[model samples]
Target: MLNALDNLTRLISFDSVSKNSNEPISDYVSSLLEELNFEVERTTYMDARGVLKCNLLACRRPLSSHPKLDETQSSSASDEETSPKNAPGGLAYFCHTDTVTADRWTGPGGDPFSAIVLDGRVYGRGACDMKGSLVAFLDAARKTPHEEQKLPLWIACTADEEVGFEGARFLTENSNAYTELVAADPVSIIGEPTMLHVIHAHKGICGMQIRSQGHAAHSSTDMGVNANVAMVPMLQTLLEIHNRCLTDEALRNDAFDPPTLTWNFGVSDGMKTVNIVPDHSNAWASMRTMPGVDGKDIIEQVKRRADELGLTFTLYSGGDPMHTDAEAPFIREFCELASTYIGPNSPEAVCYATDACAFGQLQHRVVCGPGSISQAHTTDEFIEIEQLETGIRFYEDTIRRWCC
Candidate 1:
C-alpha cells in the first residue's frame, strides 16, 4: 500500500484556500489519478476566481462506444466484461479541494502553504479538515484489491465547498453517474482524533445576508430615515426567532446533543461613522437546522419579520437540510467495517454540514470520513499519523469488500 501519511504531507503543502485558488491542488490531484491510468473528467466552475478550479471525477472504466444500454444492464455488463480489467458500478469517494481562509492565526505554523510534519502529525491548512482524507481515498484506490470483483471506483475532488458548496451543487445538478457516495469532510467524523468512528448524519446550513435601505443624514437631523438605527429592530427580531428555535421542543432531535437550531450574526455593513445616519445597512447570519425544519421556512419567517419592520432583504446563499437513515445498508456495512478495524459501536452523528447533503439528495448512500473537526481550520492543524494509517486501512478494506 502507498504510504498515506506521506501522500497527506504532499497534499497539505498546496495552499488551496477558498478565496485564493484550488487550481494548483486540483491539477496535482488530476495528475496523480492520471498516472494511475484512471480516466479523469474535470468539471470547472466559471464564476470562481481560480477559473481552472475543477471537480475531478476519476474512474477506471472507459465509456461504452455505444450509448444503448440501460444503467442497470450496463453496470452489470461492465462488471462481467471488465471483471478482469476494471472495476464495477461506480462507487464514489467525494471530498472538497478548497478550504476556509487560513487567516485566524499566524506565526511559524501560521503559513498554511508550508506543510510540516512534527512528531507524528502533519501540519498545514487542509491537513485534518480535508486534504488528509483526500489522500487516504487516493491511496485506497491505488492499493485496494479491485481486480477480483472489479467494481468501478470514482473520486470527486470538488471546489467551493467552504464558500457555498457550489462545486457539489454543480455536480448534483449535472451528474447522475454514481449511485453511491462518501463525502470525506472532517466534521462528519465528529472531531475524533482516531479513525474509530463513522458518521451517518449531519445538520444542514443556510447562510443569508440581510440588507436594509433608508435615507442617509447627519445624526442631528430627523428629516431622513436612519438605516443603521432601523437595523436594531430587525436584528432583535432575528435574535428572537433564533432563541425561539432553540427553545422549541418540536425542532429538537433526540439523536443530537442539545439539538434545535444554530444561528450566528457574522457580519454587518454600513454605519461606518458615529455621526452619520447610514443610508444602507446589512448583516450576515447563518443557520444550522435539523432535517425536520426546512430552511426555507426559517428564511420566510425572517423575511416576514423584515417586512413587518418595513425593511427589504435578500437571501445571499442557502442550502437544504439533509438526513439519511443510519440503518442504510452501505452505512451499516461501513459501521461494521469500522467496528472491526477500529473498535465496537463506531457510528456517530455530527452537527456540522457537508457535501453529503448534496449526494444524499441524489439518493446516494453517503457517510463521513476519518479525522477531527477540532483540528480543522486551526493553527498548526494536524491529524495523527496513526489516524491517517488507520483511515487508509479502513478505506482499502471497505473498497475491497464492496468492489472486490
Candidate 2:
C-alpha cells in the first residue's frame, strides 16, 4: 500500500546480490508486510560465507480473528471453501529477493542499484528479473481488503534463489508457515519474468566438476606433472555426453525452446603463465535438465569416469525440475484468467527453473508474471511500465478468485 513504485525503487537500491547478505532488504520488506496487517513469519540461516540471510512468509487472513487448521480435514478445494471462514486455504505468491551480480552494469547511469525510470521503463539491477514482480504482487495483495479475504493470503520472499535455491529449500524444510501453506493446497504463483503468460512446467539445472591436483614446477623442469593431463580423459567423457544429448530425442522436451538438455563447460588451471606446470586443474560442466532425461544417471556416469582416473568428482547440483499437470482443473482456470488479459492462450513451459524447484511440496503451482525473460540479469535490465501495471491487475484477479 505504501507507494508501489517507490517500493520498487527502494528494492532496487538494496544491492541484494546472491553473494551479499540480504538482511537489509529483508528488513524493509518485513516492515512493509507487517504494515499491511500480515502476520510475518521469519526464517534465518547463514550462507556458506557465514552471512545471515532471511526468508519471510507473511500471512493475512480475513478480518475474522485467527484461523486454526482442522486435523480431520483434507485439503480438498470444494471442502475447504465451505469448511471454515479464515481458513488456511487460498492464494500464495513467491519471489526471490536476490539478484545476479551487476558487475557489468551498462545502463544509462552506470550504477546498477540506482534505479532510473526512463522512456516509460524502470531500469535497475533487478527491475525486471524479480524486484518488479515482487513489488507488483505485494501491491496487489495489499489492495485486497482484509474483509474480502475469506481465506488466508500468503506472500513469500526468499533469499539465494539465483545461486541454488538455498533459501527456498531451507524455508520449505524449516519454516512452519511453509508447512501450513503446503497443507492448505493453495494455488501458488512463482513470480519470475514470464511476460504474463501462465507457465506450468520448467526445465531443471545440474552442475558438476572434476578436479586434479599435481605439484607445480617450471616448464623447463623434468619433474613437473601437469594436472591438465589428468583432466584430459574427463573432458572426453564430457564431450561424449554433450554430443549424445545434442541428438538424443529421448532426452528432449519439445515444449521448451531447443528441446534438448543444453550443455556447457569451462576448464581452468590456476597457472597464470603457460611456462609453469599447473598445480591444479578443474573442469566444470552444467546442463539444463528436462523432465524425461535421467540427470542423476548422467552424474553417476561422470563420477565413475572421474573415479576410474583417480580424479575428484563433485556433484555441484542435481536437477530440480518443476512440473505440474498442464491439464489440471486449476491450471485450466488460471489460464482462462490469463487469457482475459493477454487474449486466448494455453499454459506455457519455460527453459529456466525458478524457486518452484524447491517448492515441490506445494500441489498446485504456476510460474507467471510481468516482463520478458530476455532482460533478466542483463547489464541494463528494465521493466516497461505497461507490463508492471498489467502484472498488478493479473495478480489482483488471482487473489480475488481464491481469497475473496
lDDT of 1 by residue, 21-101 (tens): 678888888888986667777777675454555677776542332222234322222212234222224455778988878
- The alpha-carbon root-mean-square deviation between model 2 and the true structure, to one decimal in Å, is 2.5
lDDT (0 to 1) per candidate: 0.66, 0.86
Worst 10 residues of 2 by lDDT: 79-88
- Which regions of candidate 2 fall more than 4 Å away from where they truly are? 71-88
Candidate 2 per-residue C-alpha lDDT over 1-404 given as tens digits, one digit per residue, 9 for 90 to 100: 46778899999999899999999999999998998898999999999999899999998877874575454322553322344432336889999999999999999788999999999999999999899999999889878887887777889999999998999989988999888888786788999989889999998999988999888889999788889998998899999999988887787889899798898888999677878889889999998887777467778899999999889988875437888888876788888889877998999888889999888777778999999899998999999988998899999999998889
**Reference-based TM-score, model 1:** 0.85
Question: Runs in model 1 with CA error above 4 Å?
Answer: 1-3, 48-52, 62-90, 106-110, 175-196, 220-224, 266-269
Best-fitting candidate, scored by lDDT: 2
- Model 2: what TM-score? 0.95
Which candidate tops TM-score? 2
